[model samples]
Target: MRLERAVDDFVVQLASERGLSANTAKAYRSDLDALAAFAGGRGAHDTSDLDLELLRDWLWQDSRSGLAKSTIARRSAAARGLTAWLAREGHTTADAGARLRAPKADQHLPRVLTRSQVDGILDSLAALAATGDPVAVRDVALIELLYASALRVGELVGLDLGSLDRSRLTVRVTGKGSKDRVVPFGVPALRAIDEYLATARPKLAARNSAEETTAIFLGARGKRINSRTVYQLVASLLADLPGTGPAGPHALRHTAATHLLDGGADLRAVQELLGHASLGTTQLYTHVSAARLKDTYRVAHPRA
Candidate 1:
């Protein structure tokens, strides 16, 4: 079988059978496409031509080109998944990537905001919301829920009017793998959302001439907000803040998780709240909390 066709089939299986998210499937497809191009350059365009050596060489090339270890590791995993699928489905006689290995990605703690920093951000947004601008009010609600529920940007934008349970102060979000989980938010988030719905959402919804949208968060066009728009909103808010990592929506997620841990929230409970499939993924926030404590101790301790 042709390598390209094999990759296409593998990606389809990832989505259809494995229930991987579209973004994940797309990422695998991208990495495999690059591998296919590299193999084609080396006169190995068929599944039969793939070998363990070729897979290793592909990773080596990426390393030589200065790609981050994490990216190279992801590529290696993608290659392995493709080769394994090919072998299982009889496209290849054996798994070429079964023996493939890549450097372990460096583990850097996710960026987390200090409580004071988060408060400053929310205070600024609340002040802007007080101006009675519809978009400004929506921004307040958006950030509040982001920090409150620790929602992924995709999940946040995907929220519908029916997703909120105002009486319970919870939201029903479809998380990764299309799994549904109800997560609770604080009263602050509830108030912000209530205000947005009462004052801003109607004005924004009126701008849409198309079929009415059920989306809880509306863009300026009165349609469901896109992830890029949310990213832009967050980036602009965090641009002037003192932080080292990405200024995207996930920073708020990291902040929410770390703050929860610092305040003594149980790790297992946080795992469920963030909708992480693995508790190990949620444990990264513990390291962030510890790092912050060390910083605090170092700065305040009288003895070095």
Candidate 2:
């Protein structure tokens, strides 16, 4: 089969059979499209023309073109997935990318906020909510739940009214790979949610002429809030704060996890709370905690 056709089929299988998220499938598709273009330029237009050398050269070309190591690594993985699928489905005689490799991604610690910085952000949001504006009230609930539960922005925006268990102080969120887990939030988050539900959601919902949305958070247009809006809200809040890296909602997630570790939460429990499939993923917070402690020691130790 044509390489492009095979790439499309593999992407469909990723979404349908493997149940990968749309964003993940899209990323794979993007990388494979580039590979298909590269292959076509070399007159290797069919899956049979694919070879390990071609795959390695594709990665080498990308590296020479100045793609980040992380991006190149992801591209290599995307190619491997495609070639493996092609071989499995009998399109190729061998998995050409079975031994394909790329430079390992650079390890940069995720941006985590200080506890005092988080408190100051919450205080400002609460003060805004005091004005009785529907959007302001919703923002309070949104940020509170975000920091409280360390929810991914996609998961937070995907929440519906049925997702919350108020008496239990937990929310049912469908995370990456469509996995659902119940995550707990603090009383402060509950208070903000209650205020939003009482004074904000109804006002926003009233503006909708269509059937009422079951979404827990509404956009300005009364539809379910989208991830971009949530990102903008977080970016605006974090813009003035002193930090580098992304200022998006995931910073709150990193902050929450690091804080949990600093407070003596078990690695396994945090792994479960964050819905991470791997314990190693959750362990990144321990490194963040250690870095913070070392910074404190450098600043406060009189012996130095």
Top candidate on lDDT is 1
Error of 1 at 178 (Å): 1.1
The C-alpha stretches of model 1 lying farther than 4 A from their native spots are none
Name the weakest run of 10 consecutive residues (lDDT summed) in model 1: 13-22
Which digits, one per residue and each the tens of the lDDT, describe model 2 over residues 1-304? 9999999999998898878877988899999999999999999999999999999999999999999999999999999989898989999899999999889999889999998999999999989988988999999999999999999999999999999999999999998888899999999999999999999999998888787789999988888999999999999999999988899999999999999999999999999999999998898889889989998999999974
Cα lDDT over the full model 2? 0.94
| TM-score against native, each model | 0.98, 0.98
Cα miss at 300, model 1 (Å)? Answer: 0.9
Model 1 agreement with the true structure over 1-304: per-residue lDDT tens digits: 9989988988998899878888988899999999999999999989999999999999999999999999999999999998898889888899989999999999998888888989999999989889999999999999999999999999999999999999999999999998999999999999999999999999999999876999999999999999999999999988998879989999999999999999999999999999999999998999999999999999999994
Q: Which ranges of candidate 2 are over 4 A from the true structure?
A: none
